[model samples]
Target chain A: MMKSRPIAATLAFVAAAGLLLSGCSAPAGAEAGGEKKLTFMFRGGEDEKKAYEKAVEQFEKDNSVDVDIIVTTADQYATKLKAAIAGKEVPDVFYISPGDVQAYVQNGIVKDITQYVENSDTIDLDNIWEYGVDSYRYDGKRVGEGAIYALPKDVGPFSFGYNKTMLEKAGIPLPDKDKPYTFDEFVAAAKKLTADTNGDGTLDQWGTGLNVQWNLQPFVWSNGGDWLNEDRTKVTVDTPEFAESLQWFADLQNVHGVTPSVAEAQTLDTYQRWMKGEIGFFPIAPWDLSTYQKLGFDWDVIPYPAGETGKSATWTGTLGIAVAESSKFPEDAAKLVEYLTANKEAQQSLVDAGIQIPNLKDMAEAWAADTSTKPANKAEFLEIVKDYGRELPAGNTFNAEWYDELFTNIQPVLDGKQSAKDYLKEAQPRMQEFLDSANQQAGN
Target chain B: MTTTMRRSRLHRKEHQAALVFVAIPVIGFLLFTLFPLIFSVYASFTNWNGISAPVFKGLDNYTKMFGDRYFLKSLWNTLYMMIGIPVGLVISLALALAMNRKMRGTTFFRTVYYLPVISSIAAVAILWQWAFNGDFGLINQGLSLIGIGGPNWLQDTATVKPALIIMAVWKGLGYSMLLYLAALQSVPRYLYEAAALDGATAWQQFRHITVPMVRPVTFFLIVTSIIGGSQIFVEINIMTPTGGPEFESATIVWYIWQKAFDNLQMGYASAMSVVLGLLVFTITFIQFRLNRRNQFSID
Candidate 1:
């Protein structure tokens, strides 16, 4: 009986200890047998998952290390990643969005890979687009100026996806794919393309749709306006140029009645409407190519319409692969990041899957020339990236919050409940306050 | 001496067995519930961003709530949603009373009513969203058939709260009805018979006898409903991504989730959670006192 009691007590203690330690134990992929293991995490759709799985398999076979690839959906990625970081179960390598890079770097959750990149024999830093690389660079105070913390997976430039069938049905000439339309010309074309085909009092079809928050950069930037100055220490959105551009964008839906109302858009949403051949033009990116290929209607790509400045501009959505600072094998993780990003063969597989554009400057031309792809104006994507693509203001810390705040307040302006001038006048100071605090925190 | 030693050993063995049974729950309570509660309370007084070490900020997080428009709006929205509790109780009790009588297919009807309670919140919210959609929703189509133009139920700020409240009441009706059904079954049949002999109508008997008999159950449902209503998050999150057009449908718990997870403002979120906890506690306490006073008055 005495022997049994001690054994039972010891078993209970061990069980309790196991329960507690399981949470904080080594990574699930850590050092199986003699092979060192790497935990890689990313978020994407099924196509991206398949592409990444192939790449990981190749990487594992060549490197003699076991790689555990964790894939999450886009919606749950941020929350899951944050929870993982807080719980100290951070993946050795992960995909970081431009908006989150600053926060991750500021918290020292991501390792600085500048030294690793410089020391690598296979990677040529200059071969990648500077803006794409700059999105992940942080110098403690500002982005675009210091140590590279991540490698760019893709540089996606937002452009116009126009319904060729709809334009032809309206007997309207297609806008030049190489040279974008002037603002007035675009508006006129949109008005001509819009119609109420069923003879109902309500308009059944719209010329274009804009996701006020995501698609605002084209108008703001082409009109020679910006959210922040070069240093990102001040808010530049209060200028007359910005307000006028914003007012013009809102007028397309309100005064012009070319775009669907907020409530009407909720019925089918812009993407669905575009797929149904209802919208004349909608924002498109490289990642959307796979989905767009399934559309039955004739469609083509075009540059964003130019503003008074006669310049076309849009935001680039860049995804970067970063190494976790908590990783024990930072060098091995760096090697994996390099293989996934800098290796042309690895990128070509993803590119062939229509999930990404080539990150290498020279390779993009060849990739664009491949006639097997959809959106016949594929060359225009490269032109926009090379000529006019700008990083979203979200690349800066706290700027995303201010950007969201602006969108939240500007709804009234778009609904025609308030004027843009009055709204911007009231909003500029609040935005500046956010920028000031962020700047101070960044030691600017 | 040998017998005494054997008795002591048996007692020790029984005591050990009792401890083994108790230890599992004690460890769970400490590790899962108690630890998080204490840690969250501490987190409320700091400025932790989930990634960095928390900096002690004393009363700053608490004071900041006063100036936060979103926080105040969420609190008001939460209280506004509690309107569903009373309305839900009345409807459920009426159904319960009707079903408690000699009725055909009582089990079938009860199962039908309880289906929504068993269904996942995500599924319910998605179904309700489709029904409440502005343009192509079922509700608007029905209204149009009646020559009435339905307002945008989910999009417009003015109508969003009522739409959410209607959903909450519908979702809660089944659970509340089951509780009332059980309570009504327990009421003495003699009381109703005696009342009927006194020529009391069905309404009078229900008002005077059944209501009083079910008061304690009613109190239980009310307290739990209030607590549940105040923490409404999933429905609003699924139905309205931006908190229903300018934060109109934002509940306190939803706001806390956004702050903690979305904005990484864990400390501020924790502070708001503490406040919500206190609010629930105070309300429950007052409810208990009121119920006690009512019982005394009845006596």
Candidate 2:
């Protein structure tokens, strides 16, 4: 009887713990509102949230549909989205980066919105930038060939922002509007601009600052070296053009000593240094316009320098809005996406706030020509978009894996520990194997 | 007969009440812990991308680990970080002994030592990242003042692990010290007195009495510390956003997290997690056996 008493107590404790835990695992469901509710998830900061909130409010009033918005930090967005998908609670409309669009589409999480786009009387597919529209198109074998699954939020063109004051102080002429500096000219200008302002042995100002992963695209693409073959079936990182571009980029830090060392860069990040007018040329996107407006020095942007091919090349960063396949109200979600991406008012609101470039081709020219905007030469962004811009290798399903591998392995080469040729040579076969496997898995 | 029946009825009521009390927790355990564990084990054998249905892949996921350089490197990094555990234990024991004495401000000292344990890991990692910065950092500035050039603690491959270990040890010291203090306080004074009566010195008494008496506490500390140390994630994630300069600080859990969440390779991550679980289990089992053998020897 005593043993029974202890057993009963143990059972009570276990039962209490189990009940509490079960409560924790209770399934999350959408609120049962009288009006049709649409859930939208996005990655952004406070500014983005504010812009989205205003747009969503307008959307709700016009359509009489309720929107449940979920905003998460950029780092947490992917994990949260995956969890939502796994739990069968995916948002009706969600932001999908170009890098993730292929995988999401392949996994059957994104709905094909081609028919919706064609049927919608309000949406003119021709008004949107081809790059933005094509970013979401994915055939079984490659991108830019199949059904459109999403609409781009913006066309983020990477251009070079230079401190005009620094150029004037160095007695160097500003780069020509149409013809920016060639690779040699850019390097020479950078060398001349590099200075030791405090007369200390150490340099207080640098020629430029660039992230190997984010800013290297211009150099690689300008050199006519790409991450994948034309059809995206294989990795092509072992070519001489790719190796030479990587080496030249690294030499800007190691051999030329123009840029700050990795250790020095860690102490004060390049963004802060750029704000302090310490860098001569730094990569800037349209989104960074507001931040740069606060900088005390005179600054203007130019297209990325011409490389060995004598052609300026750049990459466009695109984030698209897609309807989830599991959405109960996919039609409504598609309408929300159309309103967010195709509506002139919504695009203008984002552009006027310096949040993003216009997704519509017609609006981009006017937005860039707004002289009241900072960077005085905002038109260069449009030039890059219309002429030299291409989507990142991540546009393909398996290409992001290859891209990440390069970024991971290229650190040694950038640090001058290994030659670019040797490193890429070693990594090429492994990358090819990975891409082959990904293709096989996709039955391509 | 009526009294016996009354007692039986009361016992029956008590039993029912107890069953009702425990039912919630048992159901919770079955739903959250047990179910997820079983699902994850099953998932380890499949190729699930979290969004799509899992497809059985037999031992493919497990076999991939044998050739995965990053996985092997992360395992090494995890074991490297465990070096901090024993070092932390010794430092905490020493501090606990000193603070356990009947001195003025003992409580204040105890509180000060326990502060890090209560503090948030994200805040601590960010603070330490600045302190460990190669240039314009407090640590480097101090080192330069003493005629020593500090290496780039977080960026350099050679020093990144040591930097992480130092941070881990510092963060863990408070909790370890409090545990040791509790164990120290419970040690009977009679054993020490007997040792003193035997003409033993202070060190001799401490060695003979305090050390042996704290064996069980030490065993508990080592087991828990090893488990916790192997799962180091937050500190590395915040301090080294790219997994350190050359993947120097990538631990097994961090790798699993990256694979599962960042790359969407949930099944592969589950397989790696299962392997990690086995590794931790083996180490803990060996420690338990060693502890038991030591106890038997003492008897």
Candidate 3:
């Protein structure tokens, strides 16, 4: 009887525990105003997260809609985003990068915002760059077939930044701040800056350290060669222009010995290396300026040198705000997007964080001359961007593979184990094959 | 008759209670592991990218794996670690043999050796990164003192894999040694005495008795170590961000991680994971079979 009593008590305890776990009340806003709660997840560090939260707070104040902001790490954000989409628990408003826009559009996960953009009085469509909007567009429209999935909220454009101290030490003439160096002169100056300053048999200082992964695409684009054709259907990377650019690129490491091997560069943390003045010439994006400035180096931004293509093209990045396809209040979500992104306060907050360049033209000019920066070259930085800017080659296929694939395929050439001609020839077919398969799957 | 029948019913209830306790855990096991495994198998067949509806990709992922150069490279790298880690296990076993003897400060030495096993792998990986740095690392400084120029440890392709192997061994040896020591103590001493009675030397007795007695532990260690070593990622991730100066150090798990997480190719990554799971299953199954078939029953 005693044993039986304990067993009975145990069963009762288990039942109570289970009920305790299951019977917990849901949060107050879980089901607000009989409308389903929508979540919006984004990747940002502490300050960006706060800025976004502030925007969300303003959004809630303006509209009678509930928005749940889920913050994730930049490293894990894409995976979680994809998983959310796959699981059909997509947030009402979320962020997308240019690299994965096509996949989202094709998969019908993102709600097209074209009509909303045109109809919504709150959103000034002209405030957004046409090219930036068009980059998200597919099938000759700024949105999915007739739908707009996302709009650009912010932008990041690449610029050639140099260490003035290193140039002075190497007896190279300081770059003309007003008139930036041309392409040939940039290469010549890099060579002059390369030196064995310590009198050691090995070189002590390198003139430049090209990031083999994220930083290489601009150089490829700066040349006439590109990863894809105009239609984004085929890979045509092995053109004569591409070969010349790659050879010149390879020479920075091999012939001139001005930069480290592609392998060494892969392992090198470029910004940190650049901060210590170990690297002289760095072609970096605007977001990197915060780090560069934070490092307190004597640095200046200059326009990227032109190739035979006769125009400079720098890789640009945009933060995209997308609406989910399955949102109950697509209209409300669109309104929230409009409110959060177009709000002047929101724009200013993003600028203040230095997370990205403001999408609104009017707001950007103010960030241009914010003299609070210690370097005091804030005006020049904006001018450099104004003169030479192009968006990163956007497509469905531009992915994490964007860096790894290019690095792996092209690294052999730098090692002299394979010729540039052979490497590009092999890479073109392989890249095209990936593009074809991915696009075909996406197109369906 | 009513009382007897009631008591019989109560006994049956008690038996049922025992069954319920066991069945609950089994049910949980079925739900968590068995169900997910079955779902993963189904997922492996289809092109499910997580967001969109899955399409039938029967045998396509499996077919694509064969032609995947990176996948093959990863497989090779994983196998390299499998081979290297066991060499470490053997050294650890040798160390355990020495420690198992009643030596001075043996308890203290055991705690010191086990320190790394308890420490966070993130901390270990970070510490090793500095130690193995090519130009300004402490390891090169020590090597220079001995008049031997240390080759670029983490930077060079040839040395990167070896360096990781060394780190893996160092990190794992303590745990493996403890396992061996425990097994060694349980081994009967009479067997050793009998061998010695037959004019056997210390080496012969160790070879004949100790080796056979510890065969089970060796098998256990080898199986678990192979699984552990194949999934090596943190060291490579921390020390060599791009899987070393080249793709030389990229392993299967890291490659899968890059594909799924970095690229947002969840479908492909899941498919790769399925393949990896199968490969591990096959190897473990084969080792289990071999161990069963060739049991050295010294007892």
Q: Report fnat for all candidates as fractions from 0 to 1.
A: 0.29, 0.35, 0.40
User: Per-residue lDDT for A1-444 in model 3, tens only?
Assistant: 765775686677667755664443233234645854556778888878988899888877777667888899776687677766655577788888766666677677888788998898877868765545655666532232334567776666766778888887777887765665565787788778776777887666677877655565656667777766766677677888777777777776777777743345543445556777777888756676566666645777766666766565666667788888877778888887776677788877877776676777667676666666634555544543454555555444535353355566465677566777778877776676766665665555
Residue-level lDDT of model 1, residues A134-153, one tens digit each, is: 88888876677799999988
Task: Summing lDDT over every window of 10 consecutive residues in candidate 3 chain B, give the lowest-scoring window.
Answer: B260-269
- Top-down DockQ ranking: 3, 1, 2
DockQ of each: 0.42, 0.39, 0.44
Worst 10-residue stretch by lDDT in candidate 3 chain A?
A: A139-148
Q: TM-scores for chain A, candidates in order?
A: 0.92, 0.90, 0.85
- For lDDT, the strongest prediction is 1
Off by over 4 Å in 1: A1-17, A20-34, A265-268, B1-7, B101-106, B295-299
Listed per prediction, chain B TM-scores read 0.95, 0.96, 0.92
lDDT of each: 0.84, 0.83, 0.72
Tell me how large the interface RMSD of candidate 2 is. 5.4
Model 1 is docked with a DockQ of 0.42
Clashing pairs in 1: none
The stretch of ten residues in a row with the least summed lDDT in candidate 2 chain B is B290-299
lDDT, candidate 1, at B223: 92
lDDT of 1 at A79: 80
Report the alpha-carbon TM-score of model 3 versus the true structure. Answer: 0.87
